[model samples]
Target chain A: MELTGAQILIKLLKEEGVKTIFGYPGGVVIDIYDELMKSDIRHILVRHEQGAVHAADGYARASGGVGVCLVTSGPGATNTVTGIASAYMDSIPLVVFTGQVPVHLIGNDAFQEVDIVGITRPCTKHNFLVKRTEDLAKTVKEAFHIARSGRPGPVLVDIPKNVSVTKIKYKAPGPVKMRSYNPTCNPNKRQLQKVLELIKAAERPVIFAGGGVILSKAPEELTKLAKRTQIPVTTTLMGLGAFPGTDPLWLGMIGMHGTYRANMSTAHCDLFLSVGVRFDDRVTGKTDTFASQAKIVHIDIDPTSIRKNIPVTVPVVGDCKCTLEELNRMLEGVDLGDLDKKRKPWLDQIQAWKDTKPLAYEQKDIIKPQYVVEKLYELTEGKAIITTEVGQNQMWAAQYYHFDKPNHFITSGGLGVMGFGLPAAIGAQLACPDHIVVDVAGDGSIQMNIQEMATAVQCNLPVKVVILNNGYLGMVRQWQQLFYDKRYACTCMEHAPDFVKLAEAYGASGFRATKPEEVESVLKKGLSTPGPVIMDFVVEKEECVYPMVPAGAPITEMLLV
Target chain B: MLDADKHVLSILVENQPGVLSRISGLFSGRGFNIESLCVAVTTDPTVSRVTLVTKADQMIIEQIKKQLNKLINVIKVHELTGSPFVEREMVLIKVHAKPEHRAEILRTVDIFRCKVVDVGAEHYTIEVTGTEEKLDAILSLLKPIGIKEIARTGVIALFREPK
Candidate 1:
């Protein structure tokens, strides 16, 4: 059948089961917008291109599908770079489409034309510039396939304006057959047998999970392994919900700002069965000292990630879920020999460390940031999908909120991009309409993407923005105070717009609370509101996230409060 | 010097516009140095062979190979350093040849199995194709004759048949 490139794109999206797209239309993408109007796919018109990409990322994280976004060329494409980098760092599955100038006009400095394919080559899993109308369908198919396949990441396809309007004899492309792109999904049985042997013999073993577990959707298998072997589970920031946070074996997050018990356990463990983690520097602290006493068994789909940071004794190259399943099957027959009784001494030691330096803070007259997150978690019954911006607000949310399911807590863990939460909440809300979506943002982070509030209100997303208003960039301020000897520098933001008024101006409900007692009531009101709402809680200005390991220091050498 | 750190990689990639850039970009982005690189269309017109030379330790070499394999355009990466391979590099040397030195230069070229492709009134442009060590030996022998200029192609290689 004859169809325009734009129509073919829409049909292929439908074929791929894409029900929603976050995008912003511009001169080059007007044809795509016109074609989109004739389809049932929901198009969220974001205020900015960055918001569109972040929203798509959030939608993908919430729905466990490839997120799609569309934007114009030049500045629109450039604006999405930060968002694309963030998704790439976290391994979120996303397909970003940017409208380019015509094929003839390319490389001639045409209006709204930029080498987006070249610019994003480093960040995207793969990228393409569609020069012909006939290649659009196949390119789109390949983009989605690469984005959602093993070790998923964002992919970009730059479509010229002329291609969108050009007619083509359309046919659904065949399944992706790139011989060079096949990832190792099923692990070798012998390597997994070795891992099983290590697990059975180790006296103190810890399961270190990361974003790969969440990306591979192997939380169930991971939890099973941890439970069956009686190994304590410690997750990286991006792996927050991979294991139940409230479980007795949960060691909280492990790394720079990790729980004292988790870091201590990692330092002392004999075997580290790290599943799906890349061993990022933030998670490793001082690489030489990280898991020094442990025999690490690193299992990940990406072979390069296995020994790129810290060397491992056993490296299994395969998908996280498949490897875990194989390991679990192998464990079915082996006699673990009374795991709980064997692990009692290690568990008791961990418990002693936890009891000695539990995550705590003083609740003064001023509202502490941790108190707000705790209250929000309580009022929402721990069922809300929480997204956070960078710095103190993010750390506090990762600490206080206990996630009982995978993908419930979404944050920019690897890239730590500011202004990610608000729009991400919008995307999450749209993905799961009935779930409570909240952006646990700081005073500085909320202002970065404040324009997204308009997008939320227009869509009636009912996304609650809970701003921890400390009147400063709290994380940087804390660092300056601790290390720089009270040289605040530019971290202090004493003069800022009133968030409640700002929310009201965006045609959304607004509330505020100054005292500690009013925090709970304000959270309740804001979360219970019908449309989009913003709750501003004035928090203590100088409160710091404790147990911070100084840069380049060992994770065990933490400065506790 | 025959150093273990130096490696020759034979990579097969799709004959696309930016495949070379992507491979080179990967090297530069990761702080890996490309000592020499050459590309040409292979027996399959749609595929190109990129022979890249780099100096790195075993771990870094493993990382480079894995990273090269990760690119979608790259079909395969083979390390030819340890394998039985026939490698060749072409070099053209322009040496200053006075009338008195002409016989000596020609005799030296004859000994090295090189050809004096171009002859000027005062200089001779000699062309030679051989292994890196052979080319180096010829260039060093000709350098004492006051070589004017030189041009060299990147090293390229193919595996030899098993006996």
Candidate 2:
């Protein structure tokens, strides 16, 4: 049957099981949106193209599916760059479709024309410019396949206006097979044996899990290996939920702004099994000193990430889940005697460090941000899908919100993009309708995407925004206070819109808590009354996130609260 | 001179728009230096071969190969620096030929097995092809005769198949 390129795209999306797409319409994408209206796929109209991409990222993280977004060319496409970069940094699977000018007018820079594929080349896993109607189906198929494949990242497909409008004989594309792209999914048996031997011989071993564990859906296997081996687990910020926070073997996030016990344990461990983690500078305070005493074993799907940052003794290149399964299976055959009994001394040492300097804060009158996050976690039973804006609020949520399951905590960990939380909460709410999705935001970061509140209200997504109103960009302020000798330097954001009125203006419920005692009541009211509500807690203006490792310092050395 | 840091990689890629940009972007984005690059369509019309030369340590060379492999357009990346290979580069050097030095220049060109591809009233444009060292040797010999202009196609390499 003859079909337009736009119809073919919609049909391919349906075949790929893409039920919803977040997008905004413009002149170039009108044909695509027109075809979308005739199909069953739900199109969410976001206020800005940036909101669409962030919401799609949130949806992908919460649902564990490839998030898809659509936007017109030029400014609309450029607006999604920040969101695309964030997803790229975190290795989030996303397929972003941008409308372009006609193929003949492409280089002419006609109306709404921009080289989106060129602009997004470095940030995308792959990209295609569909210049012909016949290439649409295969390009779409490849885009989805590449986006959700090994070491997943954002992919862009730019469809010109004429291509979208051109009609061609439609035949559904078969399974995508790229001769150039093949990801190793299975681990080598010898590598697994080597890892097993190390685990058996080492007196102190720590499992350092990262976002790859969650992306590969191997948290169960990771937990099993950790429990079976009795090794303590420390996660990167992105790996917060890969291991249960309540487990006795759990060490809080390890890095700059890491827990005292976690940092000290990393510094002291003998065998470090780093799973699905690329050693980012933030995670390793000083690369020379990081895991200096440990014989590190690195497991990741990407080969380039293995020895890019820190040298490893054993490098296992494969999917995280597959590698962990192989390692776990290898463990069952090995005659490793009584791992728990052997690791007692190491565990005791970690516990001693934990007991010595636990993560702590003080609150008397003004609302402390940490207390607010703790209360939210308590009220939601640690089950709320918490997305966070950047800065101190994000760090606080990562510290206080104990995620017991994978994909429960979403944040821009790698890019640290502010204004990610609110739109992400909207996407999460839409993806998991029954779950309570909340954006733990700060007063400074929330205003970056405050306009997205309208989309949440319009779509009837009951996303809660708990703004830690510190009246400043709290993270930078804390840094300036610590290192810059209190020369504030535009960090203070004193004059801001009253969040309650702002929420009411957007046709959503708004609540505020000024005193410590009023925090719980405000939260309870905002969460229960919700068809999208904003809860602003007037927090301490100068409170710093504790246990911060100064720049270039070793992870073991931290400025405690 | 061949050094441990200098590497030559022959990359097979899909012949499509912006593939070169993607490859070059990867290099610049990671701060990896591309000393010289040559690309053209191979025997297979759909595939293009990119011959790239980079200067990096062993670890970085491995990373550069892995990162190049990660690109969707790239089919295969083979390092020719460590293998028994044949490398060729062609240079067009236009040297000022005075009446007194004409015979001497002709003798030098004959020694280098270079052809006089183009000749003007005052200059001779010689075309030479060989290994990098051969090209450099001929250029040094001709530099004394006051070379007018020169253009070079960077190194392209192929590994010798074992008999």
Candidate 3:
């Protein structure tokens, strides 16, 4: 069909099965917005470009589909950088469309012009700048393909202002075929055999899983492998819900603020089977001492992630689901009559470690942040889809809440960006409207994008925000206390807005809990509210998250409670 | 300690937009040092061959190769090793060729098997293609006479397998 580039974009988006887009219109994108106005697809008008990206990210995480967003050029494009990097670090699939200056004015630094492609190259999985209207369909298709394929990440397509209005003969392209883009799905039999041997021979085996398992939708397969072999599973922050958190074999998240048993088991285990994990610095602590006694096995879709950080005994480059299925198939043929008997002593040791100081915090007259997370967790019964802003509040939530399903616990794991939780919770609620969605936020991080409460109010998302109001940048203050000899410089936020009034101003219900006694009633009331609700609990400002493994120190050497 | 070593890598990639940027950006973004680089289209119109010379320890180079292989347009990456491979760098040297120094410069050019592609009244643009060592030797010989201008295309290499 002969259509303008804007119409072609709509057609391509429909072809890709994109039903909704988070976007904000601007000068260069007016034509596209005009076409969108007449199209069947829904458009969410966010207050800023960052919110658009984060909303898309939240939607992607919740729905397991590529989230789409559109924004104009220059500042509009630059504003999405943090959100794009957050998605990139966490491996979220998103297709972002940005308007460009007319093709001729691209390099001339025209008004509202930016080299977004060059700027985003280091962060994006791949990006495109469409010059001709005819190439729009193909570029759109390729962008979707690249964004969702293999180890999925964000992809950007920049459309020139003229191209959006120019008419072109458009044809739907065939399936994308890139010779070098094929990701490994099936695990090598030899490597799997080696892993099997290691699992069979080792006395203590720990299965360290990560976000890849969730991204691959292989939680069932991973659980199968862990249960059949009777190996305890520890998850990264991103991998929180990949394994059922309530299972007896489930050790809580591993790394800096990891559970005692999880970190100890990892340190002492003879075999570590890491599935779909990149072993980021936060997870490994110190590379040289990480899993020193273990023969590590890493399975991931990306080959570069195999040995990028810590050395591994066996590296299998393949999709997590496919690889786990292959491992289970091979295990079906093996005799494991006495596997449990062999792992009994190891299980006992891990249980002992779990008994020793397992995520402890004292409850005083003041409302504790950890207590708030625990109460929320109990209220939701581990069923709410929870997102979190970074720092102390994030850690408290991670420690207190237990997730039983994939995509239930979403956070800015890699980037640790503040202002993520509220928008993310809004996006998640948008994706899963039937379920309860909550954003556990720190006082400092919540204020970063408190404006998004208005978004929740506008969309009627009913995203409950539980702010641990510690009146300081809790994480940085904790670091200052531990590392810098209590030099609290610029970490305190003494002059902050009254959050309750602010939430009411945004047309949402607001509540506050001043003492430990008021925490429960406030939580119950805020959660039961039909629309967006913000509940701020005044927490102990001096309290710190425990089991701190200093930077570059091994996880074994932790400053515990 | 793992000592650092220089290596040449030949990569075949799709002759498409953004592939070069992807490759170069991968290097620069990751802080991998690229000593030299050369790129040209292959016999196949749709494929471009990129030759890059980089210096890194064995681990970093392995990581670089793995990362380069991950790019969507990269078809293959072959790291050249040992003395069996042939390498070349092309240099265009414009030496001061006064009437008195003309004979000596010509003799030096002849010794290097270089062709004088262009000539001015006082300068000769001589084209030389050989190993880096040979180019360095010729450049040093012309240095005494004051080389007016020089342009060098970074290394391009190929493996000399038994045929």
Task: Report the number of the highest-TM-score candidate.
Answer: 2
lDDT of each residue in A1-561, candidate 3, tens digit only: 689999999988998999889988889999999999899998887877898888899999999999999999999999999999999999999999999999989889799999998889888888889999988888898899889889999999999999999987767778777777787778898999998898878889999999999999999999999999999999999999999999999999899999888989999999999998999988899999899999999999999998888788999988999999999999998987697688899999998988876889889999889999999989999999999999998988888999999999989999998999988887888889999999999889998888888788888889999999888999999999999999999999989999899999999999999999999999999999999999989999899998889988999888998
lDDT of 3 at A209: 97
- For candidate 2, write residues A385-436 as lDDT tens digits: 9999999999999999999999999999999999999999999998999999
Please report how far candidate 3 places residue B21 from its true position, in Å. 2.5
Candidate 1 lDDT at A292 equals: 97
Ranking by TM-score: 2, 1, 3
Candidate 2's C-alpha runs over 4 A off are B1-4
Per-chain TM-score of chain A in candidate 3 equals 0.99
Minimum summed lDDT over a 10-residue window in model 2 chain A is located at A331-340
Where is model 1 more than 4 Å wrong at Cα? B1-4
Clash list (residue pairs), candidate 3 = none
Better of 1 and 3 by lDDT: 1
lDDT of 1 by residue, A1-561 (tens): 999999999999999999999999999999999999999999999999999999999999999999999999999999999999999999999999999999999989998889999999999999999989999999999999999998899999999999999997887788889977889999999888889889989999999999899999999999999999999999999999999999999999999899999999999999999998998888889999999999999999999898898989999999999999989988899899987799999999999999999999989889998999999889999999999999999999999999989989989988899999998998899899999999999999988889999999999899999899899999999989989999999998879998888999999999999999999999889988899999999999889998899888999999998
The docking quality of candidate 2, as DockQ, is 0.85
Query: What is residue A194's positional error in candidate 3, in angstroms?
Result: 1.4
Give the local distance difference test score of model 2: 0.94
Error of 3 at A101 (Å): 1.8
Interface DockQ per candidate? 0.77, 0.85, 0.74
Task: Report the candidate with higher TM-score, 1 versus 2.
Answer: 2
